[model samples]
Target chain A: MANVLVNAPKTAKRGSIVEIKALILHPMETGFRPGPNGRIIPRNIIERFTATWNGTEIFDMEMSPAIAANPFVSFFAVASESGTVGLRWTGDEGFVVEERVAIAVE
Target chain B: MIARHFGIGLAIVFIASYALAQGMADKGGTDKRRSGTQDMGGVLQKMQDDDTANPGMLFVQLGGELWGKASGASGKSCADCHGSVASMKGVAARYPAIPKGADAPVDLEGRIDLCRTANQRAGSLTSESRELLALTAYVAHQSRGFPITPPDDPRLAPFRARGEKLWQARQGQLNLSCAICHDDNAGKKLAGVTIPEAHPTGYPIYRLEWQTLGSLKRRLRNCLAGIRAEPYAYDAPEYVMLDLFLMDRARGMMLESPGVRP
Candidate 1:
């Protein structure tokens, strides 16, 4: 599907508490299915996920197929001096997608 | 100005054609291993042989012991009500079966309810509860060696077809069909993890991540939520039908219930 989402306040002042939410779009398929010829389909899954803020990585995950499809992750990140909050998804395909949002410092 | 514009247009055309040619070449040159769906049998086999002793197996053992214990007003055990489970071997492979007068099939949880009401004289166990999972695992384990052969009777045809439809149905915000990822792109890595084919051979598994034993239906519910799809209630007919479809697809694959998995 799609990668996880990270949503938070677009702007925050230094020393403020902020809420961070991340959701990944995944099928988390168990890879036990077979093909038309009935050969066992091999397993392909996302092993890890990570998030960073202004070059400092904050949240990271080691995931399995059991984590389900499109995993939604939510947590908290303290608001320091605002910079760029970057989100990246690395999968078996290698670096599938990345997004960055500029956080305003008040 | 006109001459300059014409030159710019010719340059754009050249660049576009070159890019198109490069894309075609890349497609032919890309490594097949990078395409995903690589063989992982060795890894899976290793995991399977790693150990039979797991916390989930403990739950199954508890269920086996519970089968013989007397409970409820009848003071009768499952063994007393239904006879020896040995006689019922391979019965688990038949479940998620269509009940008489019902439009769809019933899962092991629902079947347990039938037993509770008809034989045990007890209330139905809540869906997704520990007791239900333990009993489901216990019963399914009885059919460990049996092939997953769903009935081919005429009455079952509609539900079986319906179940297959559900498997391929697209739902949720992502607009993804289960087959798209599970069937079409299976074995491709997403976020650094390999995507396993969607199979049901080893379920009611002990997930090291969850640190608890869980059923196939639980995993199904989680998948629905992950896709932003509204989940059917546990033991719901839709889920049963879906389970039947998945189980049939995993036919010939050995059962490894109470399996330990990451």
Candidate 2:
């Protein structure tokens, strides 16, 4: 699986447009069908997702199994200060993945 | 001859690169069967046999019961009005149908409204309500094993084509098309979650997380919101068209409505 990619401003002045693009590696199974061997695949799906900028979460999500696998999300943030933008994904197995990129304000 | 050779070489390279990217995109990481608690074989077997614990079956049962109950001015149950569901089986698999005098094929939601006005004498169910979802799921379940085959009447052709276009059209600030995430990049993890193939065979499903049932339109609305696109109304033609398109793509997948999802 590809690592979650977080593309955003590494540094920016306060109040500037901060672009955020995040993609994770997941198989977001809908859990409706069976596998080749013909078994009712138990539901294992990512339930929640969150993204925070310097500990202040900007985006939060309540995801259902309906979302397609390996979801990609992109949004904007007004840079208020220089800090690390952290992203996290919580799934059935546990906290399945996380990634971070530092943002600097001029 | 030199130009022909160059063209062939270019074509081969394009084909090879496309194949390689597809393989990388399709590697093991995206198998929902593997990710779930149950093993792949177990899931398939459970699907083949009717298992009570199967969350999907529970929803199916609920839908069946709802199909028989009556509540409206006409004082007619769905069974009383439409006759046995057996006659209506496989009917849902062919919706959003374009009627002779209508602009487009009425979607499942629209058909439900038609039933309400003509027989039940009640207002249409709200687009996102549980009652509507349950009924849609129960009705669609009748065609559980059938493949999705949209009606091929001439009036439907353009709408079907439009739906195909929507599936491939890129939108939102992310500049992503449904195909980019669902087709080209399926199975890749985004934010630690695997991206399953986008399929609509099992809808009006019971989501364990929501602890309730929902329809495909609600899910589509959510996706549009996630991507920052302007979402259409629940029963909007655009959504109806998209649903048809997706069902066609998901042809051959078994229906498993009222499915349980995490």
Candidate 3:
């Protein structure tokens, strides 16, 4: 279970700018910090985040170690039609989480 | 050196004021206590206020899932007996309660562990583990906005007394007690950070300093370490007693469990 959270309006006026909020729970560990045994912690971060509207990419972002734990991104997309907003986060260790939210355009 | 002397003199002044404040509290003229959230910047405050953005909600989500999903040898989940999480409202406000057939108080985590071993036939979750923290946050979230109302059982009186004594007594290499900071200097800045009047209205808090949810015991350990004092084990009775005293002190104050704090 990825424990992802997404907040977006269920209904929006067509051609209107709709705001979307997405968050995922991840440690986003940077390789620099040492553990209690004094060994460096391995770098493991969400590498990319993408949002799609009705299977077409609307926004994309590249993340690095600088991003804090539990990466959160908020963006806007135009409500052109009734469709699903799909969010995908890919990270180290073959980590992939995909979630979808439906919006009915009025 | 002169600096060391001045430090001791300042400590004495703090102690004197603390005693005076205690006297005032006894006489019912003490200053109103405020939550740590009041000391936070607006950005952080908003982060806590919004459930969608609040990181602690992630755990609460897990907790909600665990509540219904059956586990353990008995094949029972929390919902099997407790019904719905909504029924837990106002429950967190009255803990660290004295359980029946128990000599002392057990905080929420302790009670949950007891249930695991006794009723669910499951292993107890480790201290500060995600599952325990998640479950606690989920349960306590139900009590959000309800006033803290420590149970007034007669058996709790002694433990509460001991807790108050510990709260007032000076300890550590710096000879500082919880009172010197949270009592006498509350709302005053230390190293440019405001000292909140230590209240346990929130447990399983999502502290920005920790970058994760932590229990009241964890926060107490941090304070103990800051004062250069030896902290007890995570399951120490002293911690529960201290929790009881703090909650009693903050009686009538609203709970903000899964609270976000900077």
Candidate 4:
């Protein structure tokens, strides 16, 4: 199961930019590191992250192994109207997590 | 004459280092104590100050969920009895307490497990397990900003003394003691990292080193390993004693649980 945290303003003025932060718990293990048995721990990281507003994609990031564990991403998006903001993450081993939050624009 | 001069130089160096160590130890009561957070750079400190940016909050969130979820045959959750996590305030400050009928001290983690087995009728979570850490962090998080208040019962004196002995005793291949670094060299850089006073103020902390949340025992074990010393088992009483002493030493220091550290 994926443990994720997302923070965004619940309300925003129309056409104003609102900041959003998202965090997801993952080891982000680089392939070069050794395990207890002295064998290399395989690379396992969240490869992609995307955020959409009102069914339109607004923010996207391609992650790498250099990113720290429990990847946290922060960005801003223009609040066009009252709608739902959808966040998605995808990675190695077919890992995927989807979450959404609603915002009211006045 | 050359041999005699070399011997004199060696003696002076040895005495100087020993004096430095002793000077710090002698200044113990008078020396000011600073928290580990003070050693951190501004960026990391800022990271700790801000809740939304701190990664440790993720585990705190997990703990909040576990606090309410029901499990085991009793079908009772922590919320059924404790009401809310808010009720746990100031509780973590007085941990490593000697529970009734028990001769030894049990830290907050042990108390949680005791509650599970006796009250919740559930099995104890394994030491260092994610669920256990989550619950521990959640409980300690409530006590954040409160001062650490080690219990004043007289029976705890011996254990606290034992902990102090361990703190002062040198061990391992390097023959170094906790005081050698934390007390003597505190605030000084070791291998480019500044050493703090080894206070137990912030525990179950989120360390960038481990890239995960960990308890006080984990940090103790790490230091022991760093000194090339054999570490005590996870459930050893010595850890409790050491914890007891650390909390006492850090008395009046604000508890910063679920804290961020380098």
Per-residue CA lDDT of candidate 2, range A1-106, in tens?
2245456867798889887876554557678869899987766677888889889989898888878654657778889888888888888766467778899998
Indicate the residue-level lDDT of B254 in model 3.
71
Write out the backbone clash pairs for model 3.
none
Could you tell me the lDDT of residue B26 within candidate 3?
32
What lDDT tens digits, residue by residue, belong to model 3 across residues A12-51? 9999999999988998998799999999988999999999
DockQ of prediction 1: 0.02
Off by over 4 Å in 2: A1-106, B1-51, B56-59
Candidates sorted by TM-score, best first: 3, 4, 1, 2
TM-score for each prediction? 0.57, 0.56, 0.89, 0.86
Residue-by-residue lDDT tens digits, candidate 1, B1-262: 9999999999999999987864553254542222111234455444434332244555566677778887676788898967777766776776667766676677766877777776788777887677777777788777764656666656766777788898899998877777887788877776776676766756677665665667778888877887889888654677777888877776544465656566
Q: Write candidate 3's Cα lDDT for B110-162 as tens digits.
A: 88888877889998899899889999999999998787899879999999999
Query: Could you say which candidate leads in lDDT?
Result: 4
Whole-model Cα lDDT per candidate? 0.68, 0.69, 0.89, 0.90
Candidate 4 regions with alpha-carbon error over 4 angstroms: A31-34, A37-43, B1-31
Per-residue lDDT for A91 in model 1? 64
lDDT of 3 at B32: 62
Please write out the lDDT profile of model 2 over residues B153-248, one tens digit for every residue.
Answer: 777667777988987998888777788887887778767756657677666654445545567787787778877888886557888778878877
Task: Put down candidate 4 lDDT per residue, B1-262, tens digits, no spaces.
Answer: 9999999999999999987865564345765677788778999888887787788888998999999988667899999989988999998999989888888889999999888888889988998899999999999989987878999989899999999999999999999999999988888889989888899877899999999999999999999999999999998988999999999999877788888999
lDDT of 4: 0.90
Docking class of predicted structure 1:
incorrect
- Mind giving the per-residue lDDT tens digits that candidate 4 earns over A32-97? 899999999989999999999999999999999999899989999999899999999999989999
Q: In candidate 1 chain B, what residue range of length 10 has the lowest lDDT sum? A: B31-40
